[model samples]
Target: MEPVPLAVGLAALLGLSSAVLEVHVGQTSVVSIKGQQAILPLWYTSYSNSRPFVSCLLERRDPTKHLQVLTYIDGKSKVDEKYFKHRVGFLYPMPSPNVSIAINNTQEDDSGQYMCTVNLGDESSTDGRNIGLVNLTVLVPPSSPTCKIQGTPHVGGNVTMSCKSLSGKPSPMYHWRRTGPSFQVFFAPVQDLSKGTLTLTNLTTDMSGTYICNASNSAGYSNCTITLEVTPAFNAAVVAGAVVGALIGLGLILLFALQMFVYRRKKKDVQEEMANEIKEDAVAPKTLSWAKSPGSDVVSKNGTLSSMNTAQDHKLYPSKPPSDTASVTTATGSMVAYKPPYNNPRGGTLTPTPSLSSQSLPLYFPPTVNGIHCHHANVPVHRNAQHRTNGAQPQAPRQEHTLPPGLTSSTLTRMGAVPVMVPAQSQAGSLV
Candidate 1:
């Protein structure tokens, strides 16, 4: 090969120097027990006492004042007389490149950040690249964590809980567990674990129990417990049921009252109707008949004989009457003149008139006594109209009769429709 170019040769030399100017691989944080020897190992990749001399400086992390612990160079070392007189020194001399240091009889104050820095010289390219920190933490077991819950524990509520281990060599990690019939551990999420707190979402009855918080570090573990009691909330189903039951009960009571009111009103109406019918009968003309005709079709010109013959056939009455006016039908469907004996003015008597062809007929009463106005077989009665008779009238101007208060002709007809037992005296009186 031809002679190597000078510029390319210089570039290769600089790359080789950069590769070898790094800190050693084994140098890392140091941990030890109090009152024991602690070692802070540090080394460089390349060793030389030539142009840029090698040196190592140890520093402690102090903000107000820079605390320089030791300085080692040229195979010897110097330490701060006040803090590290006999406690700190180099482990090996120059030419060997073991820039490691040690602290004999390490105290509690030695547990802090210790930085080891190596320098070739002011003009060296790797000035800050060879620096590292040996974090020194003295051994101490974890203290018992003080566990506490922060909020009301009820169903559907969220609560926060905390655990703190006050003393440990390194910061302790915390885990929560529940103690009951059997042990139940809680695996908190990553977010909760970072803050050493447990957050329970949508709490339930099952979560109420003795809770334990375990704290651990490199030295040992410790735990503490707190009892948790969750209160119950109102049940929606029970409240809704009570409201519905009350409404149903009220409805039933109202319905019962309405039925009772109707029954009492109907009973009072019936009693009043019977009394009025008795009074009417007491003042009625003795010539009036309760008689059936010869064949339900024929009647005598003498009303007395027909009344006597029909006294035994008292089954013509109905239990209930129609709401509309009563009507009488003849063979030709004609409405006939029906005159009540009370209206005759002849002391309730009738004159003997010529008999007609036999046909079945009902005894008709006039409209005067109770609003019992008659309607034709084909016509309807208007309640709002003043009632009038349809038959031929006498020469005298007649006087109209008014019904008793609250009494209508339909009501009177309904009362008359009810079956009544005629005593023996009434039969004898009728015969006489």
Candidate 2:
């Protein structure tokens, strides 16, 4: 390489600053932990131990106060006037008369600044004076950080949290928050890298939200965040279920009450209709007429069943009036047995009174078999009630009649069910 420029060479040498030079009071420079009396290397862009320096300039960053520092140099106590003595007057403001800096003891008062300046008559230059301490520090290992919460708890069971640095000279600290609040029912704390764990216990809905964990060391600083949540409990749900069940039961009770009211109303309506029909029939005119009829079962217009009759026998059959035996024990309730009129073919005459017992007989017994009917009252049963055969009546003609399906028990005397064929070709309602 070509010969380095003089200024470049000199600047490079100053850059190799030694801790043995003079105390460093500049803002960005550093000193050792035991640097109270520290001597920092002095760097000159154009001066060295070999080359003579002209003067030093002392000025604060803001030089408003106009401080005037003294002038001095180290190692000038030798008896050679050529090396130590200065013939010129002292610099503008001298804190003390000329004294060699090497032999002088330094104090906090002496710690301010001094300028060592020289004059080479033909050239003039200046160097900055760095003075005043910033108290630099060399680092050792750091201490552990401590932690705590902000308040005891705000809500009844909720808590607040935070943390701090305890032993480190540089103050290492941390913070803490929980896990995810929006998704899960539980949460965990995230501790700072250099601090103790952070935890939240007995969480509730009040506990849901964000949390923070902060970590700081002498090296750097960082932080993180977490969220928390809580689940609903059984006690809350029980009351809700009970209220719903009670409402349903109350509705069922109301429906049952409405049905009972409707049933009773229908029963009263039917009873009123039957009572009105009875009144009309009782006011109808009475008549005395007679006619003959075949044994035919009669069905009353009032929906009652009666006995059977026959035309070939020309029998005089008269139905008795209502007797004291009108009382009936029925499957449903008490019923009344009423008397029906009678018919005779012999000159429309009434049967003479015989000394008949007060006991009245049934008009017709039901058919013994499928097609055979018997007139139970037409034949006089003189046989002893104890010595009677299963055949209660003698057989007549073979006029076959059959009962409706499943009506074997309901086939009463055919005559009572038989219509009075007198009004032939009349409408069914008109005959009734």
Best by TM-score: 1
**lDDT tens per residue, model 2, 16-64:** 4321122222233433321123332222222233322223232344557
Q: Rate the local accuracy (lDDT) of all candidates.
A: 0.56, 0.36
What TM-score, to 2 decimals, does candidate 2 have?
Answer: 0.23
Can you list the residue pairs that collide in candidate 1? Answer: 292-310, 297-359
Model 2: number of backbone collisions? 33
Please give the range of 10 consecutive residues that has the lowest summed lDDT in model 1. Answer: 423-432
Query: Cα lDDT for residue 17, model 2?
Result: 33
Q: Candidate 2 — worst ten consecutive residues by lDDT sum?
A: 423-432
lDDT of 1 by residue, 1-432 (tens): 112133235546776553345444244677886568888776655433443233433444566544678875664566889977898877765534456677888776777777776666532435566675677766766778788778877778878889888787777788887778458877747225545788887878887888778888776788988887766655545677899999999999999999999999999999999999998889644543222322223333432343433343323221121112233333343544432322334333321221222322234333332554432221212223366566522322222334445656454333322112221111122210
Candidate 2 runs further than 4 Å off: 1-303, 307-346, 350-384, 390-432
Query: Residue 186, candidate 2: how far off, in angstroms?
Result: 31
